[model samples]
Target: MVPLRNQLLLGHAAEALPEVRDSELGDDTYVLDRLEQGRIAWLAGQDAGSKQAFAAADSRLAWEDEQAQYRLSRGLAQAGSLLTNDQTMAYRVPDYERTMLHHYLALNYLQRGDAEGALVEVRRANQVQEQALKTRADEVRAAKAQQEEGGDEQMRQQVSRGMPELDRLIGQVKNGFQNAYTFYFSGVLYEASGDLNDAWVDYQRGYQIAPDNLSLQVALLRLARLRGSPDELRETEKKLGRKAPPLVPSIAKNQGQLVVLFEDGLIPARREFFLPLPIATSGGDFRTFTVAVPYYDNRASDSGPLAVSVGNRHEQTSALVRLEALAAKDLQERLPGMLTRQALRLLSKEQLRRSAAKEGGDVGNILVGIFNTLSERADTRSWLTLPAQASSWQGSLPAGDIRLTLGAGSAMRELPLTIHAGQTTLVWVQRLGNRLTTRVMPL
Candidate 1:
């Protein structure tokens, strides 16, 4: 009967239970099958022959000792038959199967209208299940880190940015070759996890490994633009073409101080705007182009005005302003917004809320600032900040659990965070006056 139950659980038929015709079947075999069959029968609300079958099966599995004691406890709770634990003293159930049985018992109790019994069983089963889930997650994480660090590039191919299916396949393959695909996938995974630099590293590695891949080419182009690097533009153009993707033109007075560089210069606008200007790159050496700080926004009927400042690289020089009205689908101008949305979704809800609060003045400005900082500092260390409570901003986190080597003159700090169930972590960076504070919070 025990074997029959196992077969049914495995989706095999009960009649397929192995035959032992000469001897009387033991309670282990009968009760196990009866328990399972009874549950199914109960669900269908059919008692007809199942009751007789189960009673006969239960007779063989009657409690005798330790096993009996366990069954008596379970049966009392399940049947509501008024039978106490001391009455059944002779059956045993394995611990692994125990919780599963308890769940079924709880369900049965629910069916019988014994809410208290059902609640007790549900709580116990939930505790057991929670522990099991935690164990599985820990095991999975350990396996992945092991594969990532010790396994070869082949292992990389098997790993699908945390996809279980890919991980299983990778585990089966030859364990050691690192290839362009592996790094490409790694980049995808890292990017999904809000680790842009890590993603960039993987993309860079993939590009270095296979410079001709068009996808890599696209990635390089995007990365360059985000960094506000004219040089990157030139380098990308060498492989691709000279035609520049359309971007918003800078409308700032002090284009020099705005760290973000574009052909037209730095944009200083605090609001969402659009510039239909084209971006040009040579694919040769990356060059530096300066744009004004306050950028022009053509999204509205009136093209926003430009404000040039005095302290630019071409300081005291007359500012060269390009007033261009952009179409709705300019790739450069359009892409940043799309990417920002994608990035935001990858963040935890808490992180998203903080970003929203800080950007209450102008979200576009904040988005531009983040995109430029991350892109430009691709080779350097970069961080992001979220809004703390009123009047303050959250501190920077190191992106992942990785320990970073501080760049020259970089300040370091430690943050403690709690990892919660079903939630990921988000860290924000802030620089107030000369003091840098990184506030770590849960999402």
Candidate 2:
């Protein structure tokens, strides 16, 4: 599995496609399988395959969301996994991942030249955020109830002790599910389509999430002046302080917008972290076992903002989303529920061990012990092909053919783009190692 992720990061989409081919549809990672193929095809410029794979992923998620009757079946699956481990249970996509799926779907639609489809998908993505906000209280109450019912206070305390690193990793993010990257993308689309009100709303939303982001601040300011009343414009100016965006082209002069979306590197994968749990047997003696959980390591990021230059003018892209921070925050929020489930599993496995020892003596006990140890691996599945950080750069440029120099690290590429008057041109760049995959869409 790690090799497959590594392969995708190294720009080996052809080799990685076979790992999640159509045959793995029945596996625990069906959604992840589709994501892998969809992402591979997308980065390789295979739009049709990308859309097909992503559409299948959307269908599977929609099925899960629409199935009220499936709750009982899912509950039964949880019970079954108690005797084994989470690896045996069905994979439930988290809110952030689901939102990301829709985000990519929107991008796919845009690349296919369907603004309506893209708008619909981004709205769907925002809906996921709204739903998560709506359910957060209920989720908290459920977690509290589970902790109280299971008498998992000690386990919860232990879990909290190991979370400082994760806390630090996620400190920059406001929340896990609601990311500014999607909001900015949505805002760009709305503005491109001449829907000024929607664009203003979305850009304001993104600015609220990432107040320090130059691109977001400028976007918000631009819209405020264009459509907002004087009072509203003043308020936006106050919020943004005195910092002004550099090299902005005046749309008043018939300049078009050059928007660059730079997705850099790969999202760091979750790894297994464990806690030793001592389970008391029937004879009042106890055996200790390692109970595993997923965690994101605090890896240092060396990737810098992309350098964009046209003529003597230059701009460094602003990071719109620290996606890895969102990933960390998401896992931190879900850790308690996972801990509760593992506590139940610890009890279930201990009971099975007792039964095996009584039924078949030492041999049965040893066999069950081996099985337990082997099945103790944590669930580390995630959308590994997602960028570690999503960044952007937007500026006003004279409407004409523009030759731009884009550089990230030692890698550099020259792109010749046609910028239309009073329209927006989007350049989507995926930086994988030294490989730079780009798509240009002018709206």
Candidate 3:
């Protein structure tokens, strides 16, 4: 439903605003719509408009984040969903998506040349990440309590364990929510503002999450050596092991660094399918009934690296994080809870069907069953506007007005950039469908 419309409206962001504002806006997806609207506006180079939309989305989410009652209300809301499907429940942003919200908001601020505003959003994102880790246990306990009320834990666990591809993909990351891309970006921001200490901390954390990233490895080494942290330097070098070769030298006093941020394609959307789950009937016999569930393509792909050429000098962007992988991991964490909710919903529907048969006869029961089947929709909702992959190219460039050439596949684009001495210049690039957008920020 939303996924289809999102794909259709992918490149034509500005022209599609009226469609969401006029027809498709729903009470259930207010926050999601706002997020989509913000993304599109940002893509269209409307930073102010994007800021407004993200703010509206955050207003509701901020309330939920501040109030413990709102977290408790999630279970209460599920009670109302028993008669219907999971879509009836209001959309709750996954931990990763919520963090991205602040991350994107920071970008919006940056687009407007508001560093303080961007810093605030970054701080908020960091707070949310910390909060998610702390509250994960409470959330799991709440879900467990709700599951005990209805649904079989054995069946839930079976379903969770059965998705081999999903399990492997989720295992790629430490968890479903934390990503190195955000960490790297945060570090870059802090470093741009001359906060080397905070930048060092963020880079260290990013390296912890993704040890093999060359950019992170170089950042750690460069900082440790520059700031006289020989112990930390040796430790990182040891961690790099045999992989460390052809070492990249630190930027000299006269040269500036070009930090390229490239976002490729769109995040993989969820597909819907009906699954027949086994449950015991009133007579103690097991029966299988169909329930719609959401899934994604778990296969991995290597599209090679983005090539960055400046005159004779050449560099390739390294993968920081894959959004689709993060999405899959997030979905895996959410599956158990989703299955539990589906079980409760199906059990409730069974009682309703029996009541219909008792009161109105076989015809009424058949009609109710048909209605249930028709209304049984999987909640295939997500922040569909996110990029599929995030990558970066970090290297030192001689200070001057330089022509920067960047390419991924068939087409290549060139831009003129001005790099100052002893500073960092960020080149943000996005390839959405046939259109290409680039932003230059000198720090």
lDDT (10s digit) by residue, model 2, range 1-443: 67776776687867877676464554677888888788888877789999999998899888877888766777888788887777777678878888888998988998989989999999998888889879865786787678668834555666556543786668767668878889999999999999999998888888878777788888888887777477887888788885333334454567888999998888888888877766555577867877788988876355888999988899988888878888888887777677788777777777788799899999999998899888888888788888888888998888788799999987789999888888899998888887777888877
How many Å off is the CA of 241 in candidate 3?
4.3
- Alpha carbon deviation, residue 425, candidate 1 (Å): 42
Give the per-residue lDDT of model 3 (tens digit) for 219-271: 77667666666677677677766332333455376788889988887776787
Report the number of the highest-TM-score candidate: 2
TM-score on alpha carbons, each prediction: 0.19, 0.94, 0.90
Show where candidate 3 strays beyond 4 Å: 1-11, 21-26, 68-73, 141-149, 153-165, 168-171, 241-251, 277-279, 284-288
Better candidate by TM-score, 2 or 3: 2
Question: Could you tell which candidate, 1 or 2, scores higher by lDDT?
Answer: 2
Over the stretch 128-244, how does candidate 1's per-residue lDDT look in tens digits?
A: 434544563454456445444542332133222211112221222111112343344334334434555765676686566455554455555655665577986787677666444
Q: Which residue runs of candidate 1 sit more than 4 Å off their true CA positions? A: 1-39, 46-101, 149-443
Candidate order (TM-score): 2, 3, 1
lDDT of each: 0.33, 0.81, 0.77
